[model samples]
Target: MAGRRALKAVLIDLSGTLHIEDTAVPGAQDALNRLRQASVAVKFVTNTTKESKQNLLERLQHLNFNLHEKEIFTSLSAARSLLEQKQLRPLLLVEDSALEDFNGIDTLEPNSVVVGLAPDHFNYQTLNRAFRLILDGAPLIAIHKARYYKQKDGLALGPGPFVTGLEYATDCKATVVGKPEKSFFTQALTDVGCSPSEAVMIGDDARDDVGGAQNAGMLGILVKTGKYREGDENKINPPPHLTCDSFPDAVEHILQNLL
Candidate 1:
């Protein structure tokens, strides 16, 4: 406590940290306002693939979040960047809402299978097509592998199970481009001009958000909001530096300890 460095920036998770489904967490808007007032650099990072970047931004705005398009980073965005960098034609297995992110990109004779959380796109025929392609030596690129997420009704399955299934059947390791992967957090930190040690990550998922950030050399604060189970934080090996019930609470910790 006596030797902690002053935190310079924050990476905030979306779906579970700020909102649950289409609704904003109570007081989350104010919490973000406070963070901005403190002059801490913030970047909203998410693993959701159910919508395009525009759709995600619009949704956040609808929920009264103070954010800009440049501040929002999603797994879909990372996937697109990877695809373009490698010049690989992707057989995108993502939700219809997310397809726009890859629009106008050459997908002919797809050699890469990019998987996101799209329940509607997981039918036997569709999955079979993806399976066949993978079997034929196409690389499997998982935008995210989140096991489950909290929904309005209850917890629901995420894309991790599906990604694991494909991995098992194909015997090929997937190229993960989302949370729980150090590269994602590092990339965000780099984009915001902050060193990993100078920032903190706040989110609900113990494995992805908390564990991922910690692994990437940043402090992690686990919030007990969406998708957070009672003992979720305890499940991770290197525990989060702090745990709070909501973003507002997490912000309070940051203000006191870091600023």
Candidate 2:
């Protein structure tokens, strides 16, 4: 394929693209260093909702990955932006500390509701109350839409299934403020002041990063890392523009075909 010489930015997925389970992928760090040396701007886009933006950055730094807070985009950030844009004040169903510095619209009304990963807090009473709020027409917002996430032990139920239950009980569709949604992608591009054509989305999840970016008019590159297995290509609805063995190879392809 001809190089997209106009490309100016690269959006990478954190888990599969850079590392897996707190361990940096081989050649991932070097690839990022190369991009920085070349002055090619980069952004880390993720669907993880369990950690705050600062926390995520700190973790990455601890892993020896050079990144700044501003270079990261989380689904939580997108959720906050959507709430602000819709002018919806919600009754938060999230972690108390998560909203400490949240500057978005107030989410404290009786009719407002927001759900977070509260495994320890989830119970019959709380869920019942949340359902009532939803029945009352409060807008539902979720940070992630994943059915489950990979863990050292095994797969764990993600926020998606819980969000789905709420949607079914109240018949209200939850507005997902994460990947595969155009709003989040648009927000990231706007934040960097870059066009979709100038950016490439690289990730292991075919549905979220690759398909999402392609849907928004950007190039998508799939990496064979986290959550992706051999022969998973048949499952991709909209095939990626390029597929690489790992993040390092993906970066090399970008340098050759895009830069």
Candidate 3:
């Protein structure tokens, strides 16, 4: 706390911090409004690979969040940027619904293996192709390495295990482009025109949102919502700057204390 800088912008995790699945976190709208009233820059950062950015925006709008596409940064967005820059054609192992984000990309030759949480596409044939591609020198690009995520039913496996399995089989490590990865956080912070020390990251996932932000020199606030499990905060290497009950409470904390 002694070395912490003043909070100027906030990078919020979407799935757990603001909502889980399709439902908005209780009081999330009000908390967001408070941030707007506080006049701090805000960005919504997410590792959710289940839907394309446009679909995600629609879902958020349905949940009553007033966010612009520019303010929303996804791991997929980061992956897309990298892919386009490298001019790598992806052998996509992503959800069909999420394919729209990579819509314009050329995938005819399948130069790289872009893996996300595509449950339906995790069969032997599809994975075998990705595995062979990686073994044949194509890079494995993971959107994120989340072990698991919260769903409406309960906790469910995420893409981390699958990504690692492929890594072990192919003896190739994945280039992660999502949370817990500094690029994702830094890029979002930079887009908001704030240095890492001047911004804060708020989310439910201790490892990804909180730990990742902390590692990147931003203050991290762990919210007890979404995929949060008890003792998660204690497990992080450098613990979150604060832990709160919900997004609104985190908003209150930032306004009253950090600002």
Task: At residue 14, give the lDDT of candidate 2.
Answer: 93
* Reference-based lDDT, each prediction: 0.90, 0.79, 0.91
Query: How high is each candidate's TM-score?
Result: 0.97, 0.90, 0.97
Ranking by lDDT: 3, 1, 2
Worst 10-residue lDDT window for candidate 1 reads 1-10
150-206: candidate 3 lDDT, tens digit per residue: 889898889999999999998889999999999889998776787899999999999
Best by lDDT: 3
* Model 1, total clashes: 0
Q: What are the root-mean-square deviations of the candidates from the true structure over C-alphas? A: 1.1, 2.2, 1.1
Error of 1 at 166 (Å): 0.6
* Tens-digit lDDT track of model 1 for 168-196: 98898999999989999988877778788
lDDT of 2 by residue, 1-259 (tens): 3544588788999976788778888988888988777656789999876667887788889889998998998887877776777777866655654564355456555566667665644567887888898897777887767766667676677777888998999888988888878777878887788888778999988878888888887889988888876866556767898888899899888887677
Residue 27 in candidate 1, Cα distance off native in Å: 0.8
Off by over 4 Å in 2: 1-5, 95-97, 101-107
